[model samples]
Target chain A: MENQVTRVVFYVSDGTAITAEAIGHAVLSQYPVSLTQHILPFVETVERAREIRTRIDEIYARSGRRPLVFYSIVAAEVREQIVASQGFCQDILAALVSPLQEELGVPPQSTLRRTHGLTKHNFERYDARIAAIDYTLAHDDGMSLRQLDQAEAILLGVSRCGKTPTSLYLAMQFGIRAVNYPFIADDMDVLALPPGLRPHHDKLFGLTIDPERLAVIREERRSGSLYASLRQCRLEITEVEALYRRHGIPHLNTTNHSVEEISTKVIEMLGLERRMF
Target chain B: MENQVTRVVFYVSDGTAITAEAIGHAVLSQYPVSLTQHILPFVETVERAREIRTRIDEIYARSGRRPLVFYSIVAAEVREQIVASQGFCQDILAALVSPLQEELGVPPQSTLRRTHGLTKHNFERYDARIAAIDYTLAHDDGMSLRQLDQAEAILLGVSRCGKTPTSLYLAMQFGIRAVNYPFIADDMDVLALPPGLRPHHDKLFGLTIDPERLAVIREERRSGSLYASLRQCRLEITEVEALYRRHGIPHLNTTNHSVEEISTKVIEMLGLERRMF
Candidate 1:
């Protein structure tokens, strides 16, 4: 920790500050500097802004280096306080907004716009997202097969192979109704698509993982059990991969991917319309 | 849609394109223009990049205006194809990265860095996230109070008051072990903290909603029923709010907030350390 150059960075916003944090992380990832990060969200009031400004200034005084502040604040008074601090303040949204405003020839709306807030304009979409989540929860782990028609995608995988998280991400992030079913040890003897899932084959997506990784994940849940054995994991994966290939089901190896990547790839492979929340 | 200035915007990337789309949406929200938006993810191949470039060029030729393109690609060859198109291209991360490079006195690494990818460096953190999700799912809706010691926060709310989604978001986005318990009509007669939850009073947070909104949301699930009645909603909310006040539990009205906003506020209110995934 003492070896590299450490920089203090803050992501500040009047709203959730998710956008600022995301952009800041992406920008910082490019450089080799280590970061001591803080996120200050919902900085709407002037008092809070002044406190944050003081914090930024104090960090500068203590470190003898200017802190980097990436912020998206709508109010001028609050934003000015952060700008007045002894830090390099970068407006996360302003750089792109100015060009877009010029292109559209429309003055930017000065109203406090909540990028991640619920408004009347997006209430329906928001409701749909909730519905997707509900549908997903009800159908998780093959809980129900009655509503297969409503599912945008059905994920098939062994336990802990990234099906549940990917399904939930698809529903939560993109408002897509996702169903995930697990292929347990009992199914290894006769590895075939369940009769109930046969009709929805087009929506089926498989997730397989490296046996070594799967064994490690399972061992965490049930330590020193046969279920967590490497031999079992390898056997299950071999059978599952053979089943997928025989059925011509498009699948992904989830050994090295995150839930975000798996969900995005699932949506792309299935040609599902990506709904932005 | 025709009355307003309509612009075609593309968020192109070699990865999930989530960051690009997020930044693009935040920037474009300030303007009053209608958008025909497209997200092109995983444009890793030159062939795919060329196709996207042709698509952007065709849109420009048809509209007689340069389409707006916000992209983040690590590959020079693929990025050049998008840049060569007749669109107002904006490098989403480059604008900030260049300045940070000068600040840190470190040259940026030219390797392909996947912002949302799982790697050995983050595998333990990633495992913790999955464990959080598993804990949350097991403890959702008062499924079990056996592991209250492991919970970072316990959400208390009336039915349909936005506890479940908020809890899931906290677990998924911040890797917080959140447990949500719903107050049902059966418990309204003697409204008090459950015996199991009394030990974790410090971890308890309340979520309330407007009666009208609760009724509307409930009606979507069960139309023309007592469960969806406005009177029932009002009674439940009144009792829940009184209970929250009696217990000195901090609460928020989730009537006008999105899941993201509510989750962020919960973490802020509880002073929980925000973990970035």
Candidate 2:
């Protein structure tokens, strides 16, 4: 058997640690290694930083291998503690920031920064994002049709075809007010666009899935039922896809795409404004 | 008046441009510049790449300044097109990946990478994330108490105290099954832990907000109503906070925190497993 190398990886941040984790994951995905991951977020205090440092040192002492640390810290004191650790520490944001700074010919604003933190300037945009989430939940799975006009994008698909997650993602990630309506087993016979959605035809997007994949997903939800049977899955997909073609709606197959991919594609296809919060 | 530098920024990627946007946003936040942003995802084909190159060149010609492009493309031909554009381009992932590669002593797997794409290997984890989203929605706003035992975390807070969005974020981002219950005005008079939740006290987390901020948020939902009044907001906050203290529930103030911050804090405080999907 081939020897597989293992490493302990830590994603540490003074704030949410989301960016640290994101960049670290992307970077590490390129290498072939097994990772035991630890995420340490909100390490703002010097005391917490020392504790993390000690933890890293102990892991190094026990394993005889320096753990990898990917971190972003705004505070000098807190950052210093992590830098002192017995680990292969990488400042996730500093590399990119320095190049951009040189390019822009300006010194970085020397202050505590919060990449994922909410501030007075961004509070309004943040509120809009929350409101979008509210609007999305209310309109999920055809729950409410009263305010279809307010929706930026309306998703049409059969049940378990990946509409709810995609709608919520659009709202959560981009602050887009998204509405998703599912075509159920009952609606399979006559899968037509609802009258309310007709007025918002331009906002309509569709999602379809392969029958084999659909059956597997449905089987997990309802085992040994007709809903999970391949034949029914095939029929639903066929009818729903035909409906999409008849309506001239831009659609995507959800069988292979992740929620992020689906949401980004939907936004791009519909030309929806991608508001960054 | 001092001349303020304004730049056009583009985030391009062969996959979902989420990572590019995230790193770019974090890096740009350090600089004092006004940015006009464009995000182009799935720039796989040479045709799309060429089209984007032209668009970048056109913007440069019109503005008499080079645009800043932050991109991550896997294909050599496609990446070459973007690199050849008349923009100051930066490979967002390459900077960090190279240093890490030297440290790990391994070359990167030279394959088309998708940071946000779903694959057969990660399909199960991806499914669990979707399931977490499903679980969170079903349990949102105290919708279902049947599965309290299955919940990873239970959030208790007053209305609009940043519960639903946080719960969804916990699920969507970390695949943690989160349930949020609101303490409404009706419950204030007889405020006590619901008998159903008492069994799962270890899983309980409280969210409180400043009365003044609470009033503002409530006002947006229903202006000039008693529910949105300062007095009501104060009373509800006081009662819920006391309940948190009395029950020994670990809690946080959501007044100044974003959903990302709140969710990260909650996970850290509870020592919940942070699963990266």
DockQ each? 0.80, 0.80
Candidate 2 chain B, run of 10 with poorest lDDT: B95-104
Which docking band does candidate 1 fall into? Answer: high
Tens digits of lDDT, candidate 1, B1-277: 5588888999998889998999998888888788898999989988999999999999998889889999999999999999999999999988788777777788898988887888878889999999999999999999999989999999999889999999999999999999999999899898889999999988999999999999999999999999899999999999999999999999999989999999999999888989887
Q: Which candidate tops lDDT? A: 1
Clashes within 3 Å, all models in order: 0, 0
Report the alpha-carbon TM-score of model 1 versus the true structure: 0.98
**RMSD in Å for model 2:** 1.3
CA deviation > 4 Å runs, candidate 2: none
